[model samples]
Target: MFDVQHLSYQAGRKPLLRDVSLQARPGELLAIVGANGAGKSTLLRLLSGDVAPSDGLVQFDGQPLASIPAAMLARRRAVLTQQHTLSLAFRVQELVLMGRYPYFRGQPSAHDYAVVADALATVGLSALAERSYPTLSGGEQQRAQLARVLAQVWEAELGFLLLDEPLTGLDLNHQHHTLDVARALVQRGFGVVAVLHDLNLAAQYADQVLVLRQGAVVASGVPAAVLTAAHIEHAFDIAVELLPHPSLDCPLIVPRPRAGVGAAFSL
Candidate 1:
């Protein structure tokens, strides 16, 4: 479990996050939602221990995040950032093999290879296992990165996956497929936190939702409790109407045009 308390971050004189506290348990998915620069990626960076917070604490499984040894932590948490730039020509399988680097001394063992194969299969990349990373399309490369991270923490008893805008570059089908992989990880007792942009996807898949606005938490709870029309309008400064989803058990968010805005679209 992740126990964050009074977490705050400051860059020079600018406060990016303030007094944020939240807990995420294993076997669940936590979705962080906010507008651009709402401190969403900043929160993930703090959680991943990329930078020390100005104030507060982040504990993973009851241990301070900084206390965990770097080698051990590599196997316990895997992060997929919003962008990937690989100019080299490594084979896809070789790229995925990097995730297992911490597990080996000089060379990867047979078990590591087996794990990479499983990870590739999990992300629907087995067919492209030998393709060069630079040759695959954008969405395929994204899935390859997913496979890499899965190979990292595949065997941990306590694990977490941090994804920042994981849906970027994914097609409609692949987007849902990516989240499905996340849900499957939760079933295996890995806590998953993803920074998401789409509200409807959050309502459909998130077990807990934390909404941020201007560096402060506006709301945090189950989707039904936190994703009300009023809260959406407050956090995003946009008018929206919430309606029951046609089939799912969550609300469907529909954006409403601002008053006097439609006339601008008249032909």
Candidate 2:
């Protein structure tokens, strides 16, 4: 399990993340949600080991994450950051193969290629393996990047996947597709933590929810217990109504109507 202890982070003198703690377990999807500057991304970075906490501890399976060697950590957990920018004209398959860099010394073996193939298939991009990455549409590009990260942790029996704002610019279909991949990993005994902006999606898909407000944890628990109307209003400063989903066993979060809303009429 991934564990934390009073995790606090700072940038120079500004406290970006206050004392926070949570446990992310295998076979579960943890969704981190909050407003724009609520430290959601900063907390993800700390969990990814990309930055050190000012005062706290991040552990995987009872071992200090800081002590784990870089290569071993890469093999154990794969992180897909918010940014996916590639200017070069590289084939999509070649880009996905970059995830295998930690396992091979000089050149990737046939097994690495096989892994890449599986990763591509997992993201529903097997047909676009030869296409240049920059030529694909935005959603397809995100899927390619997802394949890259999945290739990184393909070999681990118990691994972790950390995604930061993975569905930011995608269409609705791609957003669900991304979460589908994360859910698949959870079924395979991999821990998945995602920083998300959609609370309804979180309520529908996540097994656990961590709500943040201005760098502190406002609430954390199952979505039914943590995503109440009061908590939503308190953290996001907007009124929302919690309704039962028609087909799913989760709450359907609907924001309350506000005044001065613009709508096209006479269609």
Candidate 3:
């Protein structure tokens, strides 16, 4: 399991996260939600060891994150950020192969290539493996990046996948596909934590939800418990109606029209 205690991050005189504590275990998906500047991404960074917490502890399994070597850490965890800018004209296959760097160094073995191919197939980009990454559409590029991350820890038994707004450029179909992919990983005993903006998607797929307001955890529990109308209003400052999903045993959120607002034609 991945555990964090009293996690806090500060930049200069400003604090981004304060006294945050959470745990993500294998076979479950933890969804982190918050409004802009709520430090959702910052928390992911802290957990991924990309940035050190000003005060707190992060541990994977029984080892402190800071004590693990970089190469060893790469083997156990994979992170997909919100945005990636690639200027090179590398093919999609080559980009995904980069994930195997820790294992292959410079010379890739047959098993490494096999892993790359499997990763590409997992993201539904097997046909486009020869295409240039820079030439793909925004959503396609996002999937390529995801494939890279998946290939990183494909062989690990206990691994963590941390994604920050991974659905940014994906279309509706691909968005569901991506979340389904994450969910599938959990079934294989990998802990998946994602920063998601879409509450409904989180509600549908996540086993646990962590709501953040101004960098502090406002609530954490199953979607039905943490995604209450009251908590939504408190964290987002917007009115919403929560109802049970018709086909799924989860909450479905719908925006409530303001009292004075009318239809566009009525106005």
Where does model 2 exceed 4 Å of error? 261-267
Off by over 4 Å in 1: 262-267
Model 1 TM-score, all chains together = 0.96
By TM-score, how accurate is candidate 3?
0.96
**Where's the lowest-lDDT run of ten residues in candidate 2?**
258-267
Candidate 2 residue-pair clash tally: 0
TM-score of each: 0.96, 0.95, 0.96
User: lDDT of all the models against the reference?
Assistant: 0.94, 0.93, 0.93
**lDDT accuracy of residue 192 in candidate 3:** 96
RMSD of each: 1.5, 2.5, 2.0
**Tens-digit lDDT track for model 2 on 12-120?**
9999999999999999999999999999999999988899999989998899989999988999899999887776889999999999999998989999999999999
Clashing pairs in 2: none
